[model samples]
Target: MLFRVITLFDEKKNKIPATIVHGATIEIIWTSIPALILLIVAIPSFALLYSMDEVIDPIITLKVIGSQWYWSYEYSDNLEFSDEPLIFDSYMVQEDDLAIGQFRLLEVDNRVVVPTNSHIRVLITASDVLHSWAIPSLGIKLDACPGRLNQTSMFIKREGVFYGQCSEICGVNHGFMPIVVEAVSLEDYLTWLKNKINFDFNI
Candidate 1:
């Protein structure tokens, strides 16, 4: 229809018909087309927002604390740690300290461990400066502000090591602070939890 209208206009020396120029069709077309397009786009957008906000019965809850050039993780839902939670700090592996196949500035000494196919809630906060915990594959990017707690939900679909970084510029060493998430099987995660609990207990 548009092609035909353009062709007609070109053939008729840019002249428009009197009926079309004065018709209600142009007004209705302008309004209804945009409305229809918005309706088409809004459904999925609203669904994604609702999904992001919705928190299900999470099997585990992890608290992440952003510090100066490093990240700390605590497994708050682990009942084994009755008094102290299973907490550990993750530091960036320098280029000289990196092992074979390990990425420089991207690898960390410790990785955030979780089980696959489970609903996990992550609470984020900063100890000093502003930071952002983001993972591209998981589609999560949350701010870590001082004195304030932010939260997000994650459900790992598979088992792998996913890497991210402090997206917000907190300080000079912000580039060195990296985030790594290690998703394992349920049994492996339980074994890791037990080992970490024992290690913390011994300490």
Candidate 2:
């Protein structure tokens, strides 16, 4: 879908001869074609949304906190700790440790793990400044305000790692904040969650 939209932009930029034979006709054609295409696409989008609304169960819930230099995530629906809830901080990886096919400045140390085919709701808010949370594969981007909460939803269709970054400028470290999401099987997610919950830090 992003490909189509981006291609459309390219087409618009490179379209037609500058010699205007009929301005009125060109306006009508340009306006009507995009509207017609939108109508064609809106039908399926609406239907898919309505179908998802009928799901019977809530799969998972996560809370995200954007800070000056890092991001923190918590699984509110899955309890991992009694006194302290299960949470972790995600930091961007340095250039030397980055791998191929991963976008530099957009890879994190710890990526959030969720089960595939599960409805996941993310609640985003900033701790001290404004930021944005976005994932291109899922087509979701929401603002993270200091005193306000933003919510967005996405269901991972496949199991893999996806990357994103802070879309809004906050401070000196704004470019260092990264978001990584890993969609895995339910069993694998449970195993990872257990490890996260029981991690020892008493070095």
Candidate 3:
């Protein structure tokens, strides 16, 4: 119907009739249809935003500090040894240090480990410059601004290694800083966490 109307208008010689030009039905259809479509789209869009911002009772909370060319992670929830939290710096593995079948510029010396099927809260901040802690597969992209803490939540549903990089351009070595998240089963994660807290193992 719309195509035929457009065809009829295109075939007209000159002086388009005011009845069709200023038709109330046409005006209402154009305005109301787009408004209705937008309303439909906005429903799910707002729902996603609210879901992303919703804070659940997380089992573990991880603090991420972004520096010029590296990322530091802290497991502060279950710190029992001392008042200080368990902290580690995750650096990009150099090309020469990479093992067989390892991805170049994607592997890190340490990976941020979290248990599958657990609600995890991540607090992100920058020590020096602005950076973005992003993971494409998990749909997380958070800004790391100096002196300010940004919070986000994640619930890992599967066990795998998800890779990401700094989305913000902080410095010349910004590309060198990559993010790696290793999601494992709850038992394996607890074992790894025990080793991390006890032996200071970089797992």
Candidate 4:
């Protein structure tokens, strides 16, 4: 447009095209395009947000707790032998102690386990400071605020390992906090639960 204007008005000093001060067509075009684009984009956004919020009668419920530099998880459903729920803490692996094929600063001593193709509920909270529980593959990035509880639901579609890290800058060692999720078949999950139950019982 600038080159065209320069070529057209090269010999004229004061000759200029009149500007469209008030064109209803231009106004409607400008207004309707973005609104139509926004309407198209919002359909999937609202669907995903509403789907994440829906609980859908989850088969398992997991409670997550965040501290200054570590993450704690609790299996809060379907335990009968013990009054307290199954709980454990996860910490990031040190560089020197990392095993072969294990990702440094991403591996943890414990991994949160769940079953594939099943609905799961996660309740998040912080014990001392603010933290965020984020898993990119699962589209989860909920805040773990102190004195308040936040909840979300997830459904693992396949059996695999997913990894994430603490996204909030709560303290100096915040980078050291990592999260790992192990998704397995339902039979394998029950076997793991049995083994875990026995181990916790023995402990």
**Candidate that scores best on lDDT:** 3
Q: Could you give candidate 4's per-residue lDDT for residues 1-203 as a string of tens digits? A: 99998886675765675676798998999999999999999999999988768798899999999998999999978467566678988988788988899998899988899999999999999999999999999889999999999999889999999999888999999888899999999988877876776644321
| Candidate-wise lDDT, in order | 0.90, 0.84, 0.91, 0.89
lDDT value, residue 17 of candidate 4 = 57
Model 1 per-residue lDDT at 176 = 90
lDDT of 3: 0.91
Predicted structure 3, TM vs. truth: 0.75
Higher lDDT: candidate 1 or 2?
Answer: 1
- Candidate 3 per-residue C-alpha lDDT over 112-187 given as tens digits, one digit per residue, 9 for 90 to 100: 9999999999999999999999999999999999999999999999999999999999999999999999999988
Sorted by TM-score (best first), the order is 3, 1, 4, 2
Give the clashing residue pairs of candidate 4, or none. Answer: none
Which prediction has more favorable TM-score, 1 or 3? 3
At residue 103, give the lDDT of candidate 4.
Answer: 92
Strongest candidate by TM-score: 3
TM-scores of the candidates in the order shown:
0.74, 0.67, 0.75, 0.73
Minimum summed lDDT over a 10-residue window in model 1 is located at: 14-23
Model 2: lDDT equals 0.84
